[model samples]
Target chain A: MELENSGRESVLQIALLGGVYNNYLALEATLQDASQRGCDEIYCLGDLGAFGPYPDRVFPLLDQYNVTCVQGNYDDSIGNGLDNCQCGYTDPRDNHFAQLSFDYTLANTSSGNRAYLRQLPKEIRLERYGLEILLCHGSPRRINEFLWESATSTQFLEYLGKQHQADIIVGTHTGIKWLRQLADQRWFCNSGVVGRPENDGATNVWYTILDIQTGHHGSSKRRALENVSWRHVPIHYDYRRLACEMEQEAIPTEFIETIRSGWWTTCLEVLPGKERRRGRF
Target chain B: MTTPKVSLTHLDQLWFQVAGTLCNLTCHHCFISCSPKNDSFGFLSLDQVRKHLDDSLIAGVKEYYFTGGEPFLNAEFVDILCLTLEYGPATVLTNGTVLKEEWVERLRKAESLSQYGLEFRVSIDGFSPESNDPIRGNGTFGRAMDGVLRLVDAGFLPIITAARTWPMEQDAEILDRFVQMLRDSGYAQPRLKILPTLQMGAEEQRTHGYLDSERLTDEMLTDFDFSQLVCDHSRIVTDRGVHVCPILIESPDSRLGETLSAACDDFPLSHGACMTCYQFGAICSNPSGQAYRVKSDEHGT
Candidate 1:
């Protein structure tokens, strides 16, 4: 993804999308929404294929919208023809569904697209208004790590910020959106996935918009931290269509159920107690 | 062959042997042979835990885990949990026999008030008393079930962690039965964590101990991701000192140092338990724990 900004503008609003998961319909709608909202840039934290059908469809939309992307675990696996999506679900039932999804996506993803995924940077570092923003699929330390909100400590996020040398760090892998501002004015954002609902018994998925007001010359760290604000924008797409498409592709019914009902069915094992309790499953 | 060595990648998980080797009920398969009389280790005071919590913050420890003979056996268990919830997510591993409704109620409230999760992992051996009582102890099953009900009533979804005492082939059937049993007990949405048995301590007498060959070797580490091993990313703080992991606390060599920083040095994976950890990655951690799925062949797909 393009990290270099042409100039330090007064205000910069960027759209951050997480794991599309082959949900081209959501991708299309999200692009339109982001454009209509007048976002200066759009970036997708990857996993461009999985769950939803027609793996190749997401690429054209991403290209059309110029959405910069970072490689996710699923993308890394698919791009390299790996045996499984490195999702870290240890349960046999979860692994069964994960494998099914991985095989389908790997078989369906075009060679060119796979190569594109293989080359996508694991992380993207951007300098905006004196703010060093780091975007990664999971935590910067590991590609497939699940940094769940309830389980992740503030100190840990701060450590990640310092370790990665970023004022603001954004990642999407746990499929839940959360924002935490650390004691040092550093920020961590998990831009929730558009691939599926957040298992919160809500059908709508989400993305995030980070608005940074950067015009003040020689802005202090406090001023820059204050200028940054993020909003989790719930994106409503044609769930019925995606579910039907998944059904047509013979994707597991449990996955389709998650798309329709917004509660995860297969990968419930990896959820932390609090996140699991929030889900209907 | 030389023993494989694993180093701490980061202090991701900091465990506390809170109640230490002092459990109310001594199970047949107690890995540490902890019992009412076995006070080889001692309970960590609230101040002690607070100190570790402070130390953990500097190390950027992701989550805190409290295990014991039974963490709830400690008088200040609830206070420790509540205090931990303020700093980060906390998970307590208990036998479920000693859980009080009042404690659960306070914990539920504490979790709600905090930004992090407070997980209660209740240990049970089997689906029914016939199977579980024999291992955990006679009459312990009923008491544990009562504790589970109390936890559920207090709005907590306690993860029922069962050691795989039965045959591996029976895993699916056993897990299904456990889920059904939990549901019957009024836990509508039951969460379960199935654990592989660690052959040590009292378990060595109850079942066969690890064979002489059961040890991690240097050759085994060639392609394996050491991160899967708990020692690669975790350390347990005991009243004695910070150890390599909770499973190997009894071993003298497991005591890496007295402080979290000193314990970050590499450890030789020579114990029989290291073989079990190699077989089952991150077995000591919650399923939601951080993991890196290293490809067996990094160069190949």
Candidate 2:
């Protein structure tokens, strides 16, 4: 079930990541954690450049760590020389900040890295111990769609899984990580990003570790997921260092505040009430 | 010239005209012309809602919406909302005049128990009674503001939905006053949604009817994002049957079918209101669905 990103479908332990947003320090931290934890594969689900500082810093690490990348809305914008990041914010304030971040990331990213982004696949499929996994930037349908945990319904997630024919469908444009078990063994997950702290007033950004296992039923060896689970791993990177770098780069103080404090400052309008209320913004 | 047909790409939003053409207020701009005396449509019972919620799941409905002249007019509204939460997230459109503390509390409890959020889109026409009362009704501003505070006190962020009765240039000034009013009333995290006026039903009389030139032509839809139209992803379940959209329920041709699956078909964007939807997307949807703004040209489709 592998899509353009790779030829092989076989995978056991995966460190799923998303919303890189130019935070190379956190990306470095994530790579170290994934390697230390014996992850078989590392995937960065896109938005490789945004928010932090020195957009080109993210490219070398993706190459160095062998992280499979997918094209996110931000990546698509910068790659094709689009005006906005296509982050899908209608509010004037949200649009203003989004434009600023897009301009900065677009200006800073090198041509070589832009080529890499332009070539990334929109989605990737994986077969893990007989389970079909679909990895997308947002949902399986649209790139910039925000599938918030509260606003999104269980039936809808179930519908997405059935429509896409994947046992597990994971996306990460919202920057908030959550996992929900659908009917039967099917699951939907948001592999939260290391780009910034999840709006929850904590400096530790997050990622997901999807573990699949097989057990021997007496007298038979089957490739079913006897034990399949995912945990949102918090990556405690050197945010103070990242904050100083952002200051040096003259990134918006609003963004630097989100890096220092876990609460999101800009892009507040896009959030649903339940998600919005959780943030101090 | 033939009008462009909008196909049902997906049923992202499944709306219910729960209260039917009945409202506590007789807003002059009501597209459906619902009022206390008017009963062109009736209330939907809890059983009807239960059945539809199940059908919507099979139809791949992402979210559920309940609207009316004002949704709270129906006696079983709260019960209907509670049962809807069992299936998916629910958003109810209300005048904010007739909501009781008990209903709000129960809804708050139902929302807390479910993984899905319960959103209340309070239709407050203007910032003040001087502004809102003339449109919604006299003294409606006081009552709706009271309803807003009550929702805020009960830990609900009711999106203060106001229909734009004034000019576009007045948006900044109006929004400023609205934010100030909400914050002054102790709603700290105020969420606001502004809507464009649709010329139909009672509103057709208030404002002049759409000219023939205002209709959407087939060529206009070329390279146009069909997803911008609600009919592409949404259908309203009325007591009569499923309609193309919440705005076009009054049109005889808008009724697609009685069942959710049957309603998933192509529709003619021939009505004047279709032009309104073309101008403003996220019409009946919550803020989350507003990926693009009213000025669709601001962001590329």
Interface RMSD computed for candidate 2 is what? Answer: 4.2
Those runs of model 1 whose alpha carbons end farther than 4 Å from true positions after fitting are: A1-10, B296-301
Per-residue error (Å), model 2, residue B267: 0.7
| CA RMSD (A), model 2 | 4.3
The number of the candidate with the highest lDDT is: 1
lDDT of 1 by residue, B110-173 (tens): 9999999988889989999899999999999899989988988887888999999989999888
lDDT of 1 at B193: 88
Model 2, DockQ value?
0.39
Q: TM-scores of the models, in the given order?
A: 0.95, 0.94
| Clash-forming residue pairs, model 1 | none
Residue-level lDDT of model 2, residues B52-105, one tens digit each, is 898987877888999997888889989999998888888888889888999999
lDDT of each: 0.87, 0.85
lDDT of 1 by residue, A44-90 (tens): 98889888899999999999999999988888889888888888886
